[model samples]
Target: TTVLTPDVLIIGAGPSGAAAASLLRQYGYQVLVLERQHFPRFSIGESLLPQSMVFLEEAGLLDAVEQAAPEFGFQFKNGAAFLRGNERTHFDFTDKFTAGPGTTWQIKRAPFDHVLAKQAAAYGAEIRYGHTVTAVDVDGETPCADVVDEDGFAYQVRPRFMLDASGFGRVLPKLLDLESPSNFPIRRAVFTHIADHFDPAEFDRNKILISVHQQHPQAWFWNIPFADGRCSFGVVAETDFYAQFGDLALDDLLPAILASEPSLSKLLSRAEFDTPVREIVGYSANVNSLTGRHFALLGNAGEFLDPVFSSGVTIALKSASLCAPLLHRFLQGGSVDWQTEYEQPLRRGIKVFRAYVEAWYEGSFQDVVFAVEPQDEVKRMVCSLLAGYAWDESNPMNNNSVKRLATLAEICRDGRAARDALGQA
Candidate 1:
């Protein structure tokens, strides 16, 4: 019977957990991170937002990421381009309203997650791969978990506090029955990697390309390019929308769907779909409580919005950034309010993103995005939100996203109508 004790216990060695460990270790805390999978595991979220760079730099892990960028084929990204039929526009992150890092990277999650875990280890955090947390017990004064190692050795870990950074695993939420129904409708994504034989002069490698389906604007494709000339391509839509292509394997179905989008079809006409296609269903999730007695859920464990904006990693890193300092203060015998100080602020940013996601699916946000002759100031404000500056209270978009977006949509429509009338006269 082996028992271990640490000042802080983190479940999952993904971005959030790894970042939390690094931050806590910087404060001289004995932090232990348990990860079920070994290094270089496959993950779906590859695109990153600029705001994530702030958290990585704060955790002192950005230098390692930069050093390993060349090895992992990380592609430089400064903005995102959107296309719907003949309408096309792009938002340069560097021109956003909020002030921060303007550029980020399109990463391969396998190596990206590994780099983060190793950096956390380098910062003196104890990370054990192939160790899975089977059960969690928080009824006692100290939080603890039952874990089984790869070799079948079982042990117990008791830590003064626990942070659940399990990402999609939702370890504590499931163990503690904290799950709740999400407000978002069920949606799914089918994706795979391709060897894109793109001409550098023809395609802009510095931005991610999002193409809307000509027939169904709600369904869209994300083309994320890597430095090695391969691209991560995926299509997203409501779960029922996929039912039309019955019994079609991802490999066969993806190509058929791609042909339906004229713009994307033409762009990737020379691409080779060499890898296996994959699918993820109903990934949107929510929980009843974010913090409960010596423990707090981080990232997807707390809540998850749509992936249309690529906010997953940013939210994960932001959670780690917000939780670490509060945990340190609590460990130092300070009265720390986990709800107001940690959970509320994190949810505020998430709420801002949620409003946009709702508008994206409902078509209001898309109207503004594709609006002809959009106001420059309005574009910058919306660009800030797109760049993952969801927490900036100074930005008007973050404060009243839904109302402002609706108003903007109406104005765009009216302007278009007036233009049509003038042309007829």
Candidate 2:
């Protein structure tokens, strides 16, 4: 066994862990990142929001990410058609945030995560791949962690502070006896990546493309483009939907469902399959406690919402930035009243997500607004909230608007009634 000491110990090397380590290093704190796998691994949720771009720039990795930027676009759905073609919402980074791009790039997450982890290393974080954390011992004065790497090598991380960013790995959840279940009837994800299925020369690549299925309110799909004309598409639906794939191969299994959704059917009419099918179950969680003892839960480790908004990475980075300074204080032989710094913000974020998810189910999503066209002022205000700006107090939907929307949604809980004139936006 090898024993190594660091100021901060981070378990799980996804965006949150990387962000924590990167920011800690910037503060001259010795940070150790323990990852179970190597870099450049494939991941889903390839689409992004404009606010997320600002975060990447803040982390100093934006310039590096542009080398692989896909075309910028947003495809909002109402009936079957996207309200705009080529023209979409590029608001934040365009006329308002900056004249830069106003759009977030569609990316292949494998290389993207790798770039972020590498940027952390460049910022002076000590990252050890294949270093899987096995167990943890916690105390406010001293915290101990045990990690096992491949080849049966064991190492100990004795850090003054710890941040668990092991999303859905449920590290802190298990310790705290927390339960995070699938909130919707939809429980699984079936997706695939195909080459030659997406080509800028052949298909519209200016905005993010989407397919809205009218039959099920829960059903929708994304078609994201990356380098080399590769395209990724998938569905997040009820777990039992797996029965459809029972007999036929994916290439053969895709058509029947495609035909059910007019929009998806039209887009894939000319495209061809290029890879094997893949699937994952959807999960939702809310921890009773986000901080305790000497450790803290960051990002999905604290809790996770659905993937519909593509918010995993942004929240990860932001949460890490929020908590890094607190950990830094602990590392400096100073006592940290972390709860004083994190409790309110954490509760606010959790309440906001709960309200948002409740409406997604309770309201039949009649008022659930997606960006279909250039939005009017109030519409954009709601869209910005959906786009993950809930933390900003000045934002319309942050305080009063969400309350108003919640009241409206409650009044129109049933499907037909939600669409009634009184419920009109």
lDDT of 1 by residue, 1-425 (tens): 79899999999999999999999999999999999999999998889999999999999999999999999999999999898888788889999889999999999999999999999999999999999999999999898899999999999999999999898899998999999999888889999999988777657888988888888878989999999999999999998877777888889999999987887787788999999999999999999889988999988888999889999999999999999999999999998888899989999999999998898888877877787343456677788888999999998768777787777777766765322321232
What tens digits encode model 2's per-residue C-alpha lDDT throughout 1-425?
A: 67788878888788888878877888888888898888767667776655566667766667666754433212211111121223223323233311222466666777777877888899998888887887777743688887888988887888877889988786867765755563556566667876535434435653455454566655556666654556667766666665855776656665556666765565566676767777676666667677876888888888777765566676777688678777777667678666778756755654565566555544333333432223344444545554555566665445654565665455444333423322344
Worst ten-residue run, lDDT, model 2?
76-85
Q: lDDT winner among the candidates?
A: 1
Q: Which candidate comes out best when scored by TM-score?
A: 1
TM-score of 2: 0.82
Please report, in order, the local distance difference test score of every candidate based on alpha carbons. 0.89, 0.64
Error of 2 at 319 (Å): 0.7
Model 1: which residue pairs collide? Answer: none
